[model samples]
Target: MKKQFFCAAAAALAMISAAPAQAQPQTQDDPYQWLENIEGEKALDWVRAQNARSQEALEADPRFAPMYEEALSVLTSKARLALGSIHNGYVYNFWQDDEHVRGVWRRASVESYRAGAPEWETLVDVDALAEEEDRNWVWGGVDCLSPDYTHCMVELSDGGSDAAFWREFDSSDKAFVEGGFYIPEGKSSVAWLGPDTLLVGADTGEGSLTTSGYPRTVRRLARDAALDEAPVLYEGEETDVAVAAAVEQDNGGAHVFVVRSPSFFESEYYYARSEDDALGDLEKLPLPMNADFEGVLGGRAIFLLREEWTYDGETYESGAVIAYGLAGAEAQTVMTPAANQSVEDVEIGKSGLVISYLEDVSGKAARFTPRKKGGWKRKEIGLPDNGVIEIISAGGGTDDAMLSFESLTRPEALYYAPARGKLKKIAETPAFYDATGVVVEQRFATSADGTKVPYFIMGLDSVLKQGNAPTVQYGYGGFLIPILPVYYEDPARPQHGALAGLMWVKRGGVLVLSNIRGGGEYGPKWHQAALKENRQRAFDDFIAISEDLIETGVTSPEKLGAIGRSNGGLLMGAMLTQRPDLYAAIDCGVPLFDMKRYNKLLAGASWMGEYGDPDIPEEWAYISKYSPYQNLKAGEPYPKVLFYTSTKDDRVHPGHARKAAAKMDGLGYDFFYYENIEGGHGGTANQDQLAYRTALEYAYFARMLMPRSE
Candidate 1:
C-alpha cells in the first residue's frame, strides 16, 4: 500500500532547459555531446537510423518472430488476473489488453470481485477518450474522496510521461465533471479535501516552481476558482525538492498533512486543522526528518524511521515503526524487526495496522493492534513460506482487507482476510507455464568485503546437475529497492520472474536474482553500507555473484547474460567496463551512463543522495572509477551490448544511452541500440510494445548465450 501523506522528491518536472555547456567539464571533451539535445532533429535522425539498423539485425534472427509471438500471448492473455484496490464498496481497477491499448478505468463491487466473475463497469475508456481528444493519454491513477467516493481526480499522462494532467471525474455519472477541478499537464500532486475543495501542488507558472522544476508551493483551491487565485497554504524554498498536501480520512476524522521534502530522503510534516486553515500556522509533527509518515490510524500518526532516534531518553532503532497521538506528545513503538528481518511496507487497516516485512529475503506479514492502555500486540498472518506477500487493499472505512501471495514456481493467490475472520483464498491465477521439474534454491556469494550476498536460482533440477546451461541474471543494487520473486509477466507486478520462467527456464536455462549490498534486503544498514564512497561495494557484490555462478558450474562466462535497467542499468555499465569478459551479453535499458553530467539531467539532481555529486572532485574520484562512459576503452574486447531506452523518458535522459552507444561505435566496437519513440522510463507504452521489447531482450540472450549447431 502506498503511503497517503508523502511527497516524492523526484516528482517529474515540467519542461526542462538544457544545462549550459559550461556547467559540465566533459561537455567540451566529449564529441557526442550533441546527443544530449533530447528532442533535437539531428539527434532524432541519428536515433531513427540506429533504430532501423538494429531492428533489422535483431528481427532477422530466426528466434525473433517466435519469441515475439510467445511474449505477446503471455502479455495479452485474458487468463491473467485483474488486480484492484477496494475503494468504498467497489474494487477499482485499470486494465489494458490487445483491444484496449490505452486501457480502461473500471470497477466492480467487492463481493463480485471476490467471486471471480465480476460484472465490471467501465467508468472511463481511455482508448476512446484518447482518440476523441487526439492525445495518447495514459492512465496514471484516480484519487477519490473517502466514504462516498463519487468524485475523483483522474490523472492522465501524454505518452506515458510522469508529468500528467488531472481532471475531475464523476464516477456516479461515468464522465468527467463539467467545470470541476482540473489541472493542466505538469508533474502535480492533488488530494481531495471535500467534494468542492482540493489541496494541490503543481506548476503554476514562473516563480511558482522550484529550481528542480517541481512545485514548491502547495495551495488550497475552490471548485470554480482559477489556479492563480487559489490561496497559498504553505510555501517551501526553491532549493527543496518538492512540497505536497494530503488528507487521510478515518473513522476518527479527516487528518490533513503538509509534507515538505528537502531532499530525496528527508521530509518535514505539518498538520492542518481544516481544509481552509492557514498552513503557515499549522502544527509541525514531532518526527524525524528522515522518517516516513505511513498514515493516521486510531487517532495516531504512524511513522517509519530510517534512522535511530533518541527521544526523551528512549532510543528507537532505525527501521522501527512507531505511533504517536495527534493531540498528545507521548509515543509508543508499534513494532521492530529482528536482525534477520526488515520492514518492507506498512498498511493502515480500519481496525489495526498491517506490516509487511522481509525475513531473510522472504516475505512475512502481521497485524498490529494498539492496546487499550499502551504498546501494541502483533498477530502473524498465516501465509505460505518462501513467497512474496503484498497488501492489496486496506483501510477502506472497514476492517476487511485483501492480500496477494506468490513465489517463483507457485501461482498467485489472493486471500480475503476480514477483521474478525480466518484468511480465505478468494481468487487464484492459472499457471502460465509448466513447472514440473523446476526447483528454486537460495544461495549466497561472498563479496570483496566478505559480506554474504544472497541470491535466488530457479531451473530444472536435472539441467542444473548437467552444468554449463545458458543463464541470465538480473539485479537492481541501488535505491534501497529489494528484488523479490514473483510472476514477472503480470503488468500489475512487472518485477516478478514469471516471464523468465516461461520464456527461458522451460527452454532449459537458469534464472538468477541477486540481492546485492545497496538494496533494502536487510534494511537500512544493508543499503547504507554501499552509499556514496562505498558505492563500489554494490558493483563488487554483483561481480561476486557472477563469479559464484561460474564457480558452481552453473554456467561459463560464454553462456552467462546480464540484465538491468535504470540504476541497474548503471550496474550493467559498470559490469561492461570493469569486467566485460564475465558475461556474453549485457542489456542496459533506460540507464544513467554519463555520471559526470547526470546531475544536470532530468531528475538527476534529486538522486545525489544515492549517487554522489560528480561535480565535486572528491566525489568524482570514486564515481569516475565506475562511470561506464568514462571508462570505456577503444580496444577492450567488450561484449556486444544491446542498449535500449525511451525517447519520451523524462526521468533518465535518453541521451545517456544514445551517447554511450555513439562513443562505443567511435571506438570501433559493435553494439545494438533501440529507442522507443513513445513510452516513458518504462521503455514501452502498452502490452504489445512491452512484449516486443521483452522478445528482443530474450532473443539477444539466446543469440549470445545458447550453444550453436556447428
Candidate 2:
C-alpha cells in the first residue's frame, strides 16, 4: 500500500525493461537478474565494489567529516525531547544514543516526567542483551500487559528488519522471563490478551506466509504451549494482505478482534471473546469494508469513515468520525472534517477522543466526548497553530496525552495535555542548527492538469534573493503520509529536513518540501487522485514546484539537487529518466525502479491495491510509460545520481537499486552507488550509521550543486 508492487506477462514494455537488466549473468532476458540473489556471494561482491567507490568519492570531500560529526552530535544530544507513552502510572520511553546503540526500554513516573526532570529507570537494555546473545538485535517494540503494566512482550528484529521474534519480559525484575512466550521471526503480530494468554499471527514453516509474505491466519497461544499447537482463531485467504488479532483496552474492558485485510485500505473486523482458555466464534462487525476501526472507548467501537455509510436510517459522509455501540444501538456522529481539512490522527483517551488534523496544511487538534443523549461534545485543545501537531500518546490507561508541535523554522516541543486545565510544556528539542534569519514560506505551483500544488521553501533571506542559489527539492508522493515541515520524522532517512537544514541551508543553500498528490496532504482523495494510471500526476506536481523555483529565480537547473527515498526514491527515478535536465544532482535511496518485476519481490504483491497489478496488459500500458528503469535514455545529460540501498533490507528488496545501478553502468552513465552491508529497509540501523549516511548524502549535493569557492 505504501513505499510501494505486481507480476505480469512479458510484453513490449517487458522488452524495453529487459534491455538494461542485461548484464554479465543475464538470465531469462534480465542481465542483472543475479543482483536479486540478495545474499549470494557474487551479488555481494558487486555491492561491496560499488560501496567502496562511492565512499571514496564522498568521504574524500572536505565537508563530509564535519557534517558527519554535526549530525551525530544532534542525533545523540541529551537536549532532544524524550517523548513518552503513558501506561498505568509510568511514562515510558525508548532511547538510543552513542552508548546504547541498540536502545533501552526505560520509564519514569508521570509526576517526574511532567515536572520536566525525569528520573529514568531502565527496564531492558537492548544493547546489553545483544552483546550477551552475540546477535545483531534491533529493538522492535514492547507492549506491557494492561491494568498491571508488569508482564510484557518484547519484539526484537535482526538488523532492524520488519520480521521480528517476540519474548516475554518482566518489567519489575528488568529481565526477560526464562523460557517464557517465545515466537520465532516472521512477518508477525503478537499481543498480550491476558497475563497467561497471547493472540498471535506468525510463520511456522509451510503455508504460514501469504502471497504477500505476511501471516495468513491468526492464532491464540497459551503461555505453556508451542506455537504450532496454538488454537487457530481465524484464517484468511493467501491472496489477502494479512490477518491479525487486535486488542483494544479502555476503562470498560478489553475489546478483542480479528481484522482481515484483503488490501491496504480495506479491512473486515470480527469481534471475539475468550473464556476458559478457549475462544468463541467471531462475530463479523456490520460495517463497510472501507471503514477503518479507530479504537474502543466507553463501550463504543469508533471508526474513521473512508467512504460514505448509512446505518439505521442515519447517513455519515466520507471522512466523518462515527461510533457504534458494542452492545448494539444506533450509531452517532463524532466529528466531520471540512472541505479544506483532513483528519491526520485520532487517539482514544480515558476521558475523550483527541483528533489532530490539517486545515489547508495548518495543524490543529480537538478533544471530543460523546453525549449521553445524542451527538458529541467538542473542545479544541489549545496549542500553537500553523505548525505540525503530532499526538504522541493518548489512551494508554490515562486521560493525559503527550503531543508535539514544530515547523520548518521552529524546533519541536513536547507538551502534556492533561485531562483538565491548560497544556503544560514538558520540554523542547534544542535547535540543531542556526535558524536566525531563516524564512519559511509556503507557495502554490500550477501543475500541468491545472491543479495547484503546495510546497514550502526554507532558507536564509539572502539565499532566497540570490539568483540561481544552490537548492534541494525533497519529496515523497506515494503512501498516505503527509510530509510535515519538521526537523525530521524517521531518523533513518536523510531526506528529512534536519540534516538538510544543518548541512545545506546554512551554507547559502535553499531547501524545498513539496506537498504533491499521491499523499494524504488533503486526505484520501489527494492520494487516490494519483493512484495507478494517474501516477503521472504526482510526478507532474513535483516537477511544477521545481519549475516554479527556477522561474521565480530562486534556483536554476544547474544549482538544483533532488532527494527522496523509498517511495520518494521512485519519484527520484521518475525525475531521473523523465526530466534529467531539470536538476544537477539526485540522491536516490532504496527505490523501486524495475516496476515490471516489483511484485514478484518481497512484500511487493501486497501493494497491488495502490499500484495496479502489472501482470494485466491494460495496467502495464500506463505503467510502462513512466517506469524509470525502462525510460532511461542513452544520452540526456542526466545528473550524476547517488544510488544507495541496504543488503539487509527485507521490505523493499535491495535488488531494485542493485539492478538499476547495473543498468546505468551498462549505459555508460556517470553515477555513484553505495550498498550498506547491514541495515534494513531504512538503510541504517543506528544514529552512527544514519550520521554517516547523512554526511555522504550532503557531501554529494555539495560536490554536484554547490558553486566553486573563491
Best by TM-score: 1
Over 1-710, each residue of candidate 1 has an lDDT whose tens digit, in order, gives 23221111223333333343224444568899889877789999999999999989888878888878877777887777778888888998888878987899999998898787788999999999999999898877888998788989998888876778899999999999988899998878898887788999888877777665568898889889999879888999988767888788867467889888787667899986563433436788878887888888877888988888888779899989999788776788998888888898888877699889999999988999988877798899998899888887877777688888898888888888888888999888788788899999999999998999999999999989999989888888877778788764244223355677777888788999999988889888888888889999999999999999999999999999899888889999999999998999998989999998887877777677778889899999999999999999887969999999988877788889999999999999999999998887778888899888888888788788874461
Clashing pairs in 2: 6-599, 8-615, 21-31, 22-31, 23-31
lDDT of model 1, residue 15: 30
Clashes of 1: 2
Report lDDT per candidate. Answer: 0.83, 0.81
Worst 10 residues of 1 by lDDT: 1-10
Q: Write the per-residue lDDT of candidate 2 for residues 327-355, one digit (tens) a residue.
A: 77568889889887888888988868999
Candidate 1: where is the Cα deviation over 4 Å? 1-26, 275-280, 489-495
Each candidate's number of clashing pairs is 2, 5
